[model samples]
Target: MMGGELKRMDLTMCTTTHDPAPLSVEECERARLARDPAYDGRFFTCVQTTGIYCRPICPARPPKPENVTYCTTAAAAELSGYRPCLRCRPETAPFSPAWNGSQTTVARALRLIEDGALDGPGASVDGLADRLGVGARQLSRLFRKHAGATPLQVARTVRVQRAKRLLDDTDLSMTEIADQAGFGSLRRFNTVFAEVYHRPPSDYRNRKRKGRGSPTGHRALNPEPLRV
Candidate 1:
């Protein structure tokens, strides 16, 4: 676990940003053993033996010191193939403000992806990377490090989440919802929705009209970046 070393990227608009170094192993270990709520989201404990990651305040029995590694963010731990602890619910842990070099780049890329940069025909990660002034491979590494998921995964989650919101809040037809959510076609929308939520998109359509009409513009998209 190379904790906070960020390689330089070709992003010109933003100069190098320094993030605080991650908590030391000894500090994290002490916090975990004490189960200190004050230290909750500052760092996550990765137990190699169980392949699980937990908040410092996890009530579960601690793993041996040799088996544990510390990650600054849930994304980092998840990127390293550790699953979040059910007891600690690390996903719900308060976010840390610190971000290493490529993390800012990932954030920009995420916004672009969310705004349909990769939604339409001819859009690709290479194109998106070019917009961010980085290479496709480098962007992917940054995405994995900062988001714990691929860019496409993030886009797909955004689309699905937006589709769900459209389903619940609007009276849009399935086809319209599919298009608005960036799905190329209704069939494709149904397939992915079913795979993610284990239910078809139609099943989630809002039934109650209540004298409300669909908004002329699309609703705000705020998808929680899921680990797809």
Candidate 2:
């Protein structure tokens, strides 16, 4: 768990409607190398060599600092074309509630997105914005500025990351996994999984099973809110 003081600081940083005082590249690099838990959800380390992004607390050997870039959010890293690191699954990292500053509409929108509000049938950006009392265009701009991805992009990443966890931890069939992950069809699920992970779902599952002796522990896609 993060200390209350750091959580408060993160909230302050994220609440500003404009750009906040983001961690410097040098500071991020130091945190990544140090595996600092305090910085875990503050920024993600994307390795240029592997094209993978990981939580700062990732247990895999740290890559060379020169090959690393940092993103303010996992969504930002994914938008930059980096895949989540399998070893230190970014999906399992604690969600920073600070990202939802009380003043920003984007913060409320993000909470809805994380709760599968966008995964249901007939959900659309326009509808989501209407629910939040904003126009779709304004919502899109807010997402681009704060999350570094479109609403649809963030939703898709959330689904895919959830599916990845299911593949790793559950014995469910592919169809069931797809359904549970909120992918409307197995074809869509397969396409997105391959696009992000560079392999078919079954191949990833088989490889993971062979590598590990037991199922990896399951962590909910959304962690408990930051202790304020």
Candidate 3:
């Protein structure tokens, strides 16, 4: 998935400063139109019309050039008010090579977040920053500069995406899905899922099942399962 190739490129090539540089509109457009694998994860294309972001290699029909905008990172796209594309599933896209090199602190923080550092007991911004040997304020600033989202927002996205995967790929109940996906409580899970996807988690799961065959060979449960 070009993840390996991205790692091999010089990290310095990804950004010249602490903040990532914006992708060239012309080049990003070409890559989006071509569905170029080389450019996948290098930048995300946010469709203004749909309010969804996708990887360059997404198989969905490309939006008109005027309706497309590019973000240096998926986090940036999400922060810019775009949801991950249902067709392309931006979460499954390869990690941006730049993430590996340009900013090590942000990268390390992201790895920890993905591992659920922020999901349970003792998971505070101050705690995470201390683990990384930096102050909370500095860590927050760095996250905003590099990832385009606060550490909490990034962590929430990770949790929400995990919950989505479980919903799509398994018959897990909402409570089970919430726990397995690192949401401490169903109430919090439902709130965050609604904020991100503009629907209840159960609604999303039902819609996905109707559009694509159930992955686990069983009918999806009703939205009633989501009630606390």
Candidate 4:
């Protein structure tokens, strides 16, 4: 196939295919109740009492049917003002298929964002675009289409997930944790952590025992700049 034709074929393959109708709330509720990992990135479940949203694979008990709202994307849940659940690390769920198999600029941007491409030292959307050999604006448009989030928003999601992992698994100081988590500053880290997780990092860590499981078996925390 010609390059242009090949590109078109690739794009078509990556596009989401589904019935025009929405998945019934009942079906999503059943998926949530089952804690189905396969549905993790494909949908989000919101709890009425906590006002927090989680991926379908969240280990928390399923909420009553009357108390749940299903979302098609994490960005949709965030736009609706729902905070993410720390326990499930929804942001770490597998990337949308739109991102995984598509050959468009947006798909590449989504992959880079998952790798924390827009943050840490020497990282920017322009840098990402350069690496992908596309203009930054084109990259942004692709991200918005497939991810329902700007490039920056996608990057923030990745950072939040990294922060959550550090918060849950380590006793590292906040500043150290922030640095390791790819935040530019302790203040910025705190702000985003609270915004996404609905609590300060320290507060979340302090809620449970300092050490829940084995430490030595895990790698020691490293502050080196992360590529993803």
Residue-level lDDT tens digits of model 2 in 24-130? 56676778888999887777777888888899999999998767766667776777788899988885665444334323688788888878768768888899999
* Model 4 worst lDDT window (10 residues): 1-10
Model 1, 143-215: lDDT tens per residue? Answer: 9988999999999999999998898778789999999999999998999998997667765442222223346
lDDT of 4 by residue, 139-220 (tens): 7776666778877887887888888898778879999889878898999999998887677888767643323434554432
Best by lDDT: 3
Ranking by lDDT: 3, 1, 2, 4
Clash-forming residue pairs, model 3 = none
Model 4, residue 219: distance off in Å is 29
Ranking by TM-score: 3, 2, 1, 4
Error of 1 at 182 (Å): 0.9
Each model's lDDT comes to: 0.76, 0.75, 0.77, 0.69
Candidate 2: where is the Cα deviation over 4 Å?
1-103, 213-228
Question: RMSD in angstroms, all models?
Answer: 17.9, 22.7, 20.6, 21.9
Q: TM-score per candidate, in order? A: 0.48, 0.49, 0.49, 0.46
Off by over 4 Å in 3: 1-102, 213-228
Pick the winner on lDDT between candidates 2 and 3: 3
Range of the 10 consecutive residues with the lowest summed lDDT in candidate 1 = 5-14
